[model samples]
Target chain A: MASAREMRLRIKSVKNISQVTRALETVSASKVRKAINAVTATRAYATKAWQVLRHVAEQPGRDSLHPLLAQRKSVNNTLVVVITGDRGLAGAYNSNVIRFVSQRFDSNAVPVKYIAVGRKGRDLMLRRGKKVIAEFSNLPAAPTFGDVSTIGRLAVDEFSKGAADEVYLVYTDFVNMGRQITTVKKLLPLELEGEGLVEDFGNKSTGPTAAYEYEPDMRVILDEIIPRFTALQVYQAILESQASEHAARMIAMRNATDNAKELVGALQLAYNKVRQQGITNDILDIVGGAEALSAK
Target chain B: MTIRCEIISQDRTVFTGDVDIVVLPGAAGEMGILPKHAPVLTTLKYGVVKIRKGGKEEIFAVAGGVAEVQPDIVTILADRGSENIQDIDLERAEAAKKRAEEYLAKSAPADTDHYLIMEAALRRANLRLDVVRRYRKSGMRIPPSDN
Candidate 1:
């Protein structure tokens, strides 16, 4: 049973907490909208890019030219590029992805290297004594394709030079504001839809009647396009992870705000009860004193 | 017969409508397409895309990408482009061109990747500046370049 003064002080502190959480909730809500917009915009480009690559991959003998399309016979080294937010207040967003990745890696198997795009993922991997080849942190709120190109280039260079046998991207897929699923997708050994690499993009295939003519040749165009394709894939993943991060943060902040509101309500009720008890005690004391005086 | 011409970029759809004629900058040279054209797929260059429909013409500044033409549809998947002439920022384009040119001038020929990137950037900037300048000279609401 707290005194009136103690209850009043507790209520004031709870009110402050609620105010901060409410402000954070509003901020995250706006950020989520911006992140979603970025995802949709990138989706348009990614779809078209995938479609073009699929068409080229369907060509006969064209897939043999680019090294990115080749798969190694034995898995020796693997590079996992983990993307997470720099800040943590998001509920289970960063942890879910990191856990999904760590569970997949076994120390007895092929050696795994990590390339972290955010601070949270980087710190987690370092603390666990994992091999972190490169660390990129403090990315802008809305990152451009150029911003993530370094990661793409590093992955490509490693795989192409036989430094890494496999490359995988671990990220969170943004379904909507309420739902985000952690996913691990392969980034190397370029696989088209027909080869079981990319899922169907719902585009109708060009029939045999419409024989396509390439400007220079199939090989030259593919030589130029494959690198862009790899870069675009990485960029799209970054954008998706960003959107998911914002959505998770928004939901987490909203929950915090709601919980705080409930606490404030309970505290106010407790404070009122204690105040009433104090007033009643004071009245009883005064009334008893007067009765004694009258008797005298 | 009119064909649907859709110019799509990474960010947004630059232009999409039924047009009588479409002239795009092909890798070889300027190529024009009409209805019932052959099924051809080719890469695009950094230049303007002139779309004419019902005696009205629209121009778009396009960067590198691919173009696909069928009997009834012409789809352009550009890396980046703009359909609205008014949206072209001449000063920014000029600055980009200058920076790319300086980089190219200072870079060694052995650096193939940097050379290729700078070259592409310069070409894109040139095309944007060219389109915007043409619009201003044609007395469209744009003001002429100060330089």
Candidate 2:
């Protein structure tokens, strides 16, 4: 049986851990709210940008003009931009993404370059000896569009310069408060489904197939629009990933707190049992001493 | 008749409501949109976006993006925009302007891309400060500096 003193110490430590976890849970819960709002706010702009790109892409023979919309002749290299949390302890949030990347790539066939957005991904990439061309970490808690422009520009530049044939963005998708799914989205080569962006902006007067008059020719505007579209897609993905990180952290911390409480309860029970056993032992010793003295 | 005007920055929706008129800083020049405007899609310059609705007007400092105008709806999608003059952090703008100016002064003439980015930053900061100062001076009179 464990001693009462040791049990008391264990209980104290477990209680302290519970306090820390509870505090972390509260902090992450609040941060998740802001992160979710940031994602929601950027949706309108992203939707509009995508809609415009789709409309432009539908213009017959227009894909030949913009480098972003054109398909590469052959796949020589791939750029994978992984978005993970800067810090760990978020319950498989980082590992799930890292594992996904490890599983997806067979680097022997086609060379791969990594652009890590968070420290966790960077570390994983480095540990695996993968080629990481660029790394951006320690993003502000509520990241702005400017914060992500650097990554976006790099990815676009690589694809346009033929350094990378294909670019993909890997991040966590925030589905709800309780569920976040890791998703890999293609960022380059401009995938345009006829009904994709149009459905999102159905309320706008520009119907699914209506072609609007371009102010300064479609080609001129597309030169400016396509890059911005790619950048915004990256920014939106980061926002979603950030929100998911917070949600996952909050859930993980809550679980830790609950587990700590259970541990403390068990420790308290053990402490009581030990104290009772010690008391019974002391009474037995006293009675035996008295009986021996009377017999003598 | 009123047009539904929406100004969305990359971060958030700065403005979305019914407005009488919206004058955007088009790539060519300042262009105005009323209710029943023809469909036009154009890129914007870094300047002020003036929206007039019900005799009261609101002005926004838009940092370059694209604008789409329909018959009844007008949307300005920008990289950055602020409708309320109060929301523009003067200190940050001033610092950004100073940094951009210093970079411009130090950069070599051969680096046109760096120079162009600095110039754009300088222009955006100037536009934001100018709009806020104008709002402070004469509540609604947008000075006719450029068309």
lDDT of each: 0.78, 0.81
Tens-digit lDDT string for candidate 1 (A1-296): 97788888888898898788778878888988998888887776676676666555555554364567766789899998899989898888888888888887745388899899899999888888889999888998778888888888898889889999888888787788898878776778756545554432222444332556777675666667777777787788888889999889889888888888898899899888888888999999999999999999
Compared with the true structure, model 1 gives a TM-score of 0.79
- TM-scores for all candidates: the values are 0.79, 0.77
Given the true complex, what DockQ would model 1 score?
0.46
- How many angstroms is residue A275 displaced in model 2 relative to the true structure, after the best TM-score fit? 1.5
The reply for model 1, stretches above 4 Å from the true place, is A103-109, A194-213, A289-296, B1-5, B17-23, B31-41, B50-58, B68-74, B84-147
**Model 2 agreement with the true structure over A255-283: per-residue lDDT tens digits:** 99999999998889888988988999999
lDDT (10s digit) by residue, model 1, range B79-119: 76555566788888899999999988785694587788788
The pairs that clash in candidate 2 are: B30-B147
Model 1's lDDT to the true fold?
0.78
- Residues B1-147 of candidate 2 have per-residue lDDT tens digits of 888887888777777788789999987789999998877889887778888866767677888789988787888887764555657888888998998888887865845877887888888788778878887443453322221
